[model samples]
Target: MTDIGYIHHEEHMRSSDLISDIVIGMSDGLTVPFALAAGLSGAVASSSLVVTAGIAEIVAGSIAMGLGGYLAGRTEADHYESERRREIAEVESVPEREKAEVREVFAGMGISPALQTAIADELAKDKVKWVDFMMKYELGLDEPDPNRATKSALTIGLSYVFGGLIPLSPYLLVSHPHEALLYSCIVTLICLFVFGYFKSQVTGQPPVSGAFKVMFIGALAASAAFGVARLFG
Candidate 1:
């Protein structure tokens, strides 16, 4: 039973974190570069320039996403560690107060006062477990593995490059620049809609609405960029 419980907990934690990372990585990788390509394709006449921009966007965007994810994850880990230390200090120095707070928290959640006191007593007996429990239940924080951050960043960045390629591939193969631009736009829009729908599913929102919202925003941005470029060109 204990082994089963541990396995379930570990699996849940890992799967949840993985889904979040994939969604974030794919979202950034696919949308921004696609938008950049779509907008630039309209303004530029040369296939060489379009290809150059697409390649640049993929490489630059991947690095940016990777670095950003790594730094963000590192910062979060640092903050969590700091807080955990603080929590330990408080538990050691002002144990009665912290215990009382824990009792109250449980009581407020409808645990009987007697049970809450008993639970708190048991928890306080094991200082490490008590601190961990407090962090999870009271503070709603889980200590993330430091290495996962780098892995997440690299995964996301790579995903972004892949997603970005979807929109740019048509332009690379087709000879007609105008047709390429149209096909790229179509592909990008379709991908965006799908991405938005999946994002909405993961986030518990209306899928169609979310899809439309992203599409509208991307369309607006692409249109604005195209208009500005044409005016300047």
Candidate 2:
């Protein structure tokens, strides 16, 4: 009989940093412009004004959000690099102590004292690997991508623009703001529910509840804005 090899497979759904940026950008993009357009519809008769205002908001919002993402990414990368340099210095100055920390990490995993010492000694032979291993196990930091800042900025900015376009599209076609608002409301509400549902699924929350929550919040914000505009206009 021929020998057979067994393959093991595991599958899991995870939410990534990119997904988080998209959620932040898209959620605000969809809700903010939607609320603005709804409010303008209450105050004005011309769809042209609503479309113009919505476009302006989308441009400003995307830039502001992208800048925020870039700053956050930069801070994260900087923090990690600073910590890594400190770890390297510690490794050089107190080699024995650093080795002890390595053994401690293995010990925490239920490794035998002898095995821990053996593994730590082996790791200490290579300074770079030792420092990197310590960074991961002791400091709990993985190296951030060098281009994380630029990538985050672009992702958030583009996602915002894409989401912002949905509600504003109806206003471009309809001459009357009120008619455009009706179509915008229908389209945006559907999108909010769908977006929230998928967002919750990826993030491991209850999908239906999350969808309803998102939808309710969007409607309430727009309603409040519209009411205010109508009252004052």
Please give, for residues 27-131, the per-residue lDDT of candidate 2 as tens digits: 988899999999999999899999999999999999999999999999999999999999999999999999999989988999999999999899989999999
Candidate 2 is scored at a TM of: 0.93
Candidate 1's C-alpha runs over 4 A off are 1-15
Clashes of each: 1, 0
Q: 1-233, model 1: which lDDT tens digit per residue?
A: 25654544332123365677777777766667666766676677776677788889899988888888888889889989998999999999999988998997898799998999899998999999999988888888999887977887887788788887887888888866567878887887888899888777777789899998877776676667666767776
Lowest lDDT block of 10, candidate 1: 6-15
For candidate 2, list the clashing residue pairs, or say none.
none
Residue 2 displacement in candidate 2 (angstroms): 18
- Top candidate when judged by lDDT against the true structure: 2
